[model samples]
Target: ILAALSFFATGSTQTNLGDNFVLGLSQAMTSRSIKEVTDSMTEHLASRHIRFPNTANEINRIKEGFFLKHRIRGVVGCIDCTHVPILAPAEADEDHPPIVYYNRKGYYSLNVQLVNLLVNMKILAANSQSPSSVHDSAIWAASIIRTNVERTFRKGNNIWLMGALLHICRNAQPGTPEARYTLRHSQTRNVIEKCNGLLKMRFRCLSKQLLYHPIRVGKIIYAAVVLHNLAIDFNLNDLNDEEPLIIDNDENVPNIHNNHDVLNEGSRVRANFIRRYF
Candidate 1:
């Protein structure tokens, strides 16, 4: 069963898996079994592995890890979105038109939001419910993790996740605080990039166009994320011979609303952060 799962995850089709010497079953049977096993494993494993810190101790441990490793304080995790390619849906309803899945990259995909601990490379949350047409910022705004963090802040917890910094001044003097902050911020955020790359590299199916329905593809993604955490827990060797292909939607610029109050607050926070840390 494990071998079959690995084969299935590595992009082998049901027909191919069924034709294998080990399986030797019909394609229909293989497909049915795969779905059953995937759903079962995801349900059991996701509950155990794929989740954010809920308690004060757990949250502080993650923040300490970030501060120790990256010199970034109060960072519990890093958040980013990655595109998972899927076959175009054959039918569409009014709520979900066909074009909704067609991303700016000219392919059908699901925009999956992943938040992870950078020090240990453990996925804290995997949200695969958004269509590719959804902007990353919109997804971030609606994310449960974001809401939880906000609620925690209101309670004086003051923990947060690192996200993309828009419009860093690249031409700042090399030794200036702005340049120093940019350098450190980019270095710290690179963990998310490596995390996404490692995920696709390990689960080859994610790199390929998933041939399942969008919903099923989402399940596969979740299952893969669970397996990824397991692999990390077991200290499995990484597959780094080849770089994973990460398809990002360059056109999906985050929509920043024209709210002067919010803008001023953000600028104030950033300046203070730079002055204190950089």
Candidate 2:
């Protein structure tokens, strides 16, 4: 720490504290054993007095509280995916499935999907810790809070729950109030995309091809999230003055016949298998 800081103080860029700190944070957080770093991070967070939701109950409350008051169109939250690059041990394929094609490393990953609802442009709920292979839509369907949203929509007839994702996104069953709502409100709900960009940009380690052991990679990913949540808690990196861009989207996308469509269409027998499986 002293070495890096001294170099920075001397205005030396080749081997400065800023570079060392970035390397240290990445190596310690993302590429080291999480069990070791989480303890230190926990202690650090304790000193800072920063708190993040550690359970599903707290997450649910945040969601309910946000939507209960906001009267925004077809939007409850913004949904998107981010990849945490992980190590690819040659032996991993023996236990794991085939290759994950979409990752930066094209080796392995813990695909984290973050869903956040912003109230007054502040993050309300931030969901994380999903497997790399999980689908964006499936995460929404499996969300504990979303089931309640569906039930509420069903009772109030406030909007129809003809299908799941559309209702959550506020896209209606074609020409419905919810459909118009989804298109109109999607502009306000795009904060997650921006958040992803800022996070990747701020932490260049995440933007790079991760070269670390798998176990260490998991810890690094969690540590980054914990640090991010802490920043949000303290308003450290919060950007409220910047006016967010809003787009006008009127086009509606169609949902499948049922929840099984992603798997069924890829193969002839697989399609039949999905019909029976669902």
Candidate 3:
């Protein structure tokens, strides 16, 4: 079963599994069987491996690490979205325009958000099933992790999430506290970019366009993340040895108007951080 999963998670097909050496031992296993085995393994291991920090100590460790290493006070994790390309699903209406899966990049994809621990590259949580058309800030606003962070972390134990800005204000003077803070935050939070790169590079399936059902493709993503976490936890250097891939953010993209209250709160929090720490 492990072999079956590794083969598929490595971006190889079930047909390749059947044609390769392992299953050919007694009799060539059918592609259907190979798929079944891998699917089962992915689900079981994902349940066991992927997890969020539950206790206060665990959460504190993450916060402390971010503050000490990244120099980002109040940050527990860095959040960002990446597109996983996929073929448009069948059984769709041909007459209507494709709006659900079509992203701004002119392709069908799933916008997967990953939240990784800054101290360690371990993936603490992820939301991988969102349609590609959704905006990154939209995904963050809807995340369950956002609610949990609010509920658990109190006023004194403030935990802020870091993400790239879609647009920067032209009025802010260069080398000002606000501008400097933004620059430092972007540089420190870039570890998530490395985390995403290592995951895709290690599991070639993520780097290639997936030719599977969107639902199943989500599972593959989760499974790949689980494997990436395990590799990091186990001190495996092979996956991390590769240089980080250059990920492009939506620079110069105009910000969408959102709830006034939410925007005010975010601005206030950032202002407090700059005043207190930056």
Candidate 4:
């Protein structure tokens, strides 16, 4: 199973896998069967390996890591979205049209959201269920991680995931606190780009167009994420020297237009952060 999974992650076709393995295996295994295996592996591995910090100690460790590495405090993770190219869905029906999978990039894809612990480049949350047509902000608003973060905040926990803040420092003087904060924030948030790039480089399947059902493609993505974390655990270094892709932020600034309270709170937080750190 591991061998098959390794081959899958490395972007081997089913025919190639069959040629390498036994005939009985060939007769039993189809693309759908492989997807089934991948799904099972993803679920099992994610349950065991991918987890958000729930305890104070675990949360503090993550915060400490961010502070030590990026000179930024209270950042538990970095969040961003990456598009995984896929073939247009053949199974599209009236309710789920094929055009829905077409992204702004001129291709069919899944807009996958990832929240990674910048300190270790380990993914804390991954959401591959949204189609390419979905906006990143909508995906974020609908994410379970966002819900959990809100709940945690209500309970008096004040941690946050780092996102792009370049807009805030726009046109500001170079030596100003806003400019300095933006510089650090960009440096810190860049880890997610590296993580996404390393993940695709490590798992060749992600870098290429996945020729599978849209649902199966999502499962494969999850499996790749699990394997990526496992590779990090094992200290594997099979990635190439290619530059990691920088994921473009659909919306860099937080949306505070709808709620004055949110705008005020964010302003207060930024002011406090700049005053104390920048």
Top lDDT: which candidate number?
A: 1
Mark the 10 consecutive residues where model 2 has the least summed lDDT.
157-166
lDDT of 2 by residue, 166-260 (tens): 33322247765445455544543454455665555434445554454454444444455555556666668543357343221212222444646
| Candidate models: Cα lDDT each | 0.79, 0.44, 0.69, 0.75
Give the per-residue lDDT digits (tens) of candidate 3, residues 11-78.
Answer: 66656555667556222454455456547656677767767776777778877888788776767777
Residue lDDT tens for model 4, 1-278: 74456555667676666666553356236454676778787867787777888888888899998899898877788888888888887653665567988987688888898888877788888888788888667788888888888888788877877764223555768889988988887776666677787777777788778877778888888888887788778888765557555444433233446877766776787777778778
RMSD of 1: 2.7
Off by over 4 Å in 2: 1-35, 42-70, 73-77, 97-108, 120-131, 140-164, 167-179, 237-278
**Model 1 clash pairs?**
none
Higher-ranked by lDDT: 2 or 4: 4
Model 3 worst lDDT run, 10 consecutive residues: 246-255
Error of 2 at 63 (Å): 7.0
Please, what is the TM-score per model?
0.89, 0.52, 0.83, 0.84
User: Of the pair 1 and 2, which is ahead by TM-score?
Assistant: 1
Report clashes for each candidate as comma-separated counts. 0, 7, 0, 0
Against the true structure, candidate 4 has what lDDT? 0.75
